[model samples]
Target: MEYIQTVLFQVPASRLEQASETGGLLAELDGHRAYLKQQPGFRDLRLTRSINNEGNVLIVVETRWADDESLVRYETAEPNVAGIIRKHEDLLVRDSLQVLDMEALRTEASFARLESAEAARSRLVLPLIVPLGVLAFALLAIYGLSRIYLELDKGSAVGLATGVAIGILLIAVYVANNPRMPAWQVGGIFVVVIAALAGGTIWALVQEDEGEATGEPTASASPGASPAGSPAAGGGELALTLGDNFFELAGQKSPTLSVAAGKEATVSLTNTGIAPHNMHVADAGGQYPEAFCNPGGATPCSDPNLIKAGGTATIKINLGAGTYDFRCDFHPLEMTGTLEVQ
Candidate 1:
C-alpha cells in the first residue's frame, strides 16, 4: 500500500508585491519538487492554487509516496522539506498551514464513485478473498505434484510449489485492483502456469529420449562425470549446472565436488533455468574467507560472470586442501553446494 500526504496553506494578497510573485513562488516550488523527486519512493508532487471570494489564495500541495517508511524517512531527515516549510513560513497567513496523512485503501475509480455502500464493500472484500482462495488452491496443487513426482528433493519441490502460490497471490491482487476485469481472464493466469509446467516436463522427457538415442550422456545419470557437450576434462575442467534458482554439480542439484590439493579446477557452468544467474565460490570455514579455484587454502573468489537464461560460463581457480562452498549469489539458500579438497 502507498501513502499520501496533502498540505494546504493560505497566502494573503498583501504578502505579494504583484501577480508576478505567484509565478516566483511556483518557480521556487518547482525547485522543491525536483529535490523531492531525487528521493527514493517519491512518486509524485503536485502544486495548485485556488482563490476564494474573499480574495485570499489557497495553495494546495499533494504528494504520493511508495510507502509509509519512505514517507517517514523523508519527513525525519529531508532537509529539502524543512527548507520549504521555513521558506514559506513568512509568506503564509498566520496559522494557515494544514497537513494531513492518509493511506490509500482502494484505488478503483468505481469504488470511489459507487453510490451504494454495500456495492463498494463487496468490491473491496472480493479482492482479498480471491487471493486467499487462490493461494490455498495453489498449495493443494503443489502437494499433489509433490506426491506424483518422486525425484524432486523436498527443498526444490517446496520452492516450485511456493512459486505457484506467489503467482496466484499476484494474480489475485491484480484482479482486485481491476474490479471490472472479466472472471475468465483472471482464471487464465493459473491455467497458463500449470500448462507451462506440464509442457516443460514433457519437453525434458523428450530431450532425455533424444540424448539416449544419440548416445550422449545425461547430467542426472552421471554424477561426478563431466557435463555433456562440454570441454574436455583432461586437467582441471569440472561442470556446474544452474536451474531455476538452484545449482547442480555433475547433474545432481547441490551435489559436492572433489578436487586434489595444489591443483587448479576450471568450473564450466550451464544454465538450464529460466532466469539469469551467477556463481561465487567462498571458503566455508571462514579461515580462508575467499573463493577457491583449485586445492588452495585461501584465494580471492572469481568475479561473478553473468549467465543469462540458457547460457554458460567457464571459470578456473586454484585452492589448497581445504573445505569450500559454492553458491549462486542471487539465490544462496536454494542454490548452494560444497567443494571438498582432498
Candidate 2:
C-alpha cells in the first residue's frame, strides 16, 4: 500500500564538515524536502547522517510515497537523487553509494490498531488534559492580575491590564490569521507574555512586603473593635467582616462569637475585600443536612445570598445553646469561624 526509496552514501568526516560550512550536501538535501513536497504522492522525507566503521560519514536520504507507481515516477524524473549524487560525486567517497527501493509491509490490521489507539487517546486523554490546562492558565492569569491590582492604584492597574491584554490579543490575531508565522516570532511572543506575568507578580509581592515592613495593615488584618455605634455583644446584634480569604470578628481570625440562647440574634455580614463571600452556620451537632443544604453545603443558618465585594447581608439566628461551625460557602477552608449560642 506504501513505498519507500532510500539513497545512501559515505563521505570523509572532514568533507562532510566542509559541505556543512559551504551549504553543499546537507543543504541540498534540506532543499529536496521542500521540492519533493510539491510532487504527487510524496508522503515524507528524512535525511540522517552517522559515522561509519571506515571513519567516513554515512548519510541516508529516505523518502516515502503513497504507492509504487509514485516512487517509479519520481525516479524517472530529472534532477532526482541519482542526478543529485552525480552532481556531488567529488565530495563523496568513491564506490560508496547505494540506492534501494522497498515495499512497506504494514498490514491493514496494524493500521486498524493504530487508528484505534489514536481514537482512544482523543476520547480519553485530550478532554481531561485540555480543560485542566485551560483552568491552570486561567488561575495563573487571575492570580497575576489580582496581585497587580492590589499593589497599584486603580488607574494604574486598569491601564496596565488593558495594555497587556490588548497586546496579547493583537499577537493572537496576527498568528491566527498568518497560519504560517515563523517559529521565532511565536517563541518571542510566549517569552514576552511569560516575562510580563512573572514580573508583575514579583513586583506586586515586593511592594506588598515593603508596605508590611512599613507597618501598613493588610486587607486580612483583624477589624479589631466593632464599628463605632454598632450594636454591642449583649444587645443581640453582631457584625462580621470578610476580607481576602479570611473572616474576622471582634479583632480575631476565625474568632468565636457568643449569642444569647433561644433569643433571636441579628448577625450582619459585610464583605470588605474584592471577592464574594457568605456565611453558613451548621445545625446543632454541627451537622449540615442534605435537605436543608445543597451539595457541599453548610446550612441550618446562612445568609440569604452571597455578599458581593463591598456589599452587606443580614441573617437572623435563634438556636439553642450550642457551638456551631460557620464558614464562607464559597471559601470554606480559608474563611471559617464559630458561633457559640449560650
Query: Each candidate: what lDDT?
Result: 0.64, 0.73
Give candidate 1 misplaced runs (Cα > 4 Å).
1-234, 284-304
Q: Write one digit per residue (lDDT tens) for candidate 1, span 1-342.
A: 668878787777776554226555556667678778888999988778878776878887788888899887877775544346556677777887887888888656446566567788998999999899788767655654543242233345578678768977997898789989887885687578667656656654554445344322333423355654343334456777778987775456787776666666676666666555666678546433533232222443333345544555665656677778777655767877777776
What CA root-mean-square deviation does each model show from the true structure?
28.0, 20.1
**Predicted candidate 2 versus true structure: per-residue lDDT over 1-342, tens digit per residue:** 778899999999878776776567677777777779988999989888899888999988889899898899999987677668768899899988899999888956569989999999899998998799678767778898788776664347679879978987898799889999998997787678777887888987786656544422322332442452243446445677777888787557887877777777777666777666677787777664542333234454445455555556666777788889877776878888887777
By TM-score, the best candidate is 2
Per-residue lDDT, model 1, residue 339, is 73
The pairs that clash in candidate 1 are: 293-317, 293-318, 294-317, 294-318, 294-319, 295-319, 295-320, 296-319, 296-320, 297-320
Best by lDDT: 2
Residue pairs that clash (backbone atoms under 3 angstroms), model 2: none
Residue-level lDDT for 98 in candidate 1: 82
